[model samples]
Target: MSINWDDLKVALAIVRHGTLSAAARALGTTQPTVSRRLDALERSLQAKLFDREAGGLRPTALVLALVGGLEQMDAGAFSIQRQVAARDTGLSGEILVTSLDWLGDDVIAPMLARFGAAHPGVQIELINGTRVFNLARGEADLAFRFGSFEQENLIERRVGEVAYALYASTEYLQQHGTPDVGDGFEGHRLVYLDRAAGEVPHEAWLPALARHARIVLRSNGLRAHMAAVRDGVAMAVLPCLLADREPRLRRVALPHPAPVRWVRVGFHSDMRDTPRIRALVDHVVGEFELLGACLNPKQ
Candidate 1:
């Protein structure tokens, strides 16, 4: 007898999440349902897939060996279903896209607004966060990332390059005076991206230029960093896309150009054949190309 796809999905979820409750949460179902599915799957296969222990559900050796292959099959099956549906319905479905907060708000959202007008039936969901969403695990349909992909099973294309520039409120520049590379930023206060100095290329580069400058404010949130800069709390290295439109902040000329970083659009390779996903990916790349001039225009 062929194994039930839904039962296999339930088993895979339990293995990945480590408990029935967690699997239920991920699958948007009740614990009893998950447990029943897992039981049915094991009985049908006549194998013990998991062994309960203090650490959590530890998959048996047989299960561990089978899981990798099963996951690939699951992803392929999902893609096939999506492709069939897209073919039958002419690409009408919801596509979820995740990206960095600033890009999501300033760039992708506006592009989607125009895209929505053209593809009126296709629903788009945008998830904006600094943390990387797991595409392999099917957390997001697509991702706009600053750098390259970690998985070999992902298709990545460079969408654009984002430039960073020194920006400060008019009042702050007036009071503190802009410092050049040789001046060492000794007297001025600086705002920094919090968490780590090495998280982003721009964040790391800024601190290196002003090693002696006082870090008066630090934040991980892009909006908070912009607010700090706008309120004259400190000067910051702001993305040109975000800083160009803010009237409160003025771009300070640096002795040299800040390094440019690449922005890439990525999706799981398994989903590449799906019509809806392909359409969304093409739309995103086209939108970025169209807006490249606007995103980094010089003042």
Candidate 2:
């Protein structure tokens, strides 16, 4: 019997995730179905593809040998799918773009508005939230993200970098005095991001700075954190793109250089070349290039 591509795909997913349940979740199937397909594939090939281990399922040498070819096939299949999608001549359709909430005010909002005016046929749905929207599952057509992305079967381009700095309202600074370099946050109250929305690399460094200071408020949203800081509730580490422009706030110079995060634009590989997706990606990249200096100011 010929090898079934469907069964091979299941095996690939299992190998990638290291568990039947996780593979099922990625494949949108049940664990039982994944197990059945994996068993069938092993039987057809007459080879033990994986060894169940205490930690997780480990692929055998033979299975490892097959993975490289499978990945190449996956890429080719995705390329063909994208080519087919690109065949749609008409550009009129709804394309969703997901980004952090702060960008809605000054950064992406204007670029999206200009895109709308230029291409009135294509509808743009801008989703602003604290979490990164899933691009592979169609939750968003495109995403503006920070840090390194490692998900397979997706494409990303680095658009720019985001710089972060300690910021406080003028009233708070005047009342408590600014934190000098290497002061260990003495007598400071911090308004910080909650753990739920604390995946950014810079957020991890905040605990060290606020180790001595008291955490007065923790928020999952940048807008809330900004509001707290602006209201003179507490000091916060904020993005330069947002805080630098505010006249009421001041950037506290730290002994160390402020953290910088890479801004990446990501989308599913299968939709990379689609007309609407391509247009959005190109426009956003150009917009970032135009505002790169502001987004990533020299520290």
Model 1 spans > 4 angstroms off: 1-3, 43-48, 85-92, 130-139, 196-199, 268-286, 289-294, 297-299
Tens-digit lDDT track of model 2 for 80-133:
655564565566677778887776556777888898889988888888776776
| Model 2 steric clash total | 0
**Which residue pairs in candidate 2 collide?**
none
- Candidate 1: give the clashing pairs: none
Measured on C-alpha atoms, candidate 2 has an lDDT of: 0.79
Error at 173, model 2, angstroms: 1.3
Worst 10 residues of 1 by lDDT: 81-90
Question: Against the unseen true structure, what C-alpha lDDT does each candidate score?
Answer: 0.80, 0.79
List residue ranges in candidate 2 displaced over 4 A.
Answer: 1-85, 88-92, 104-106, 130-134, 147-151, 197-199
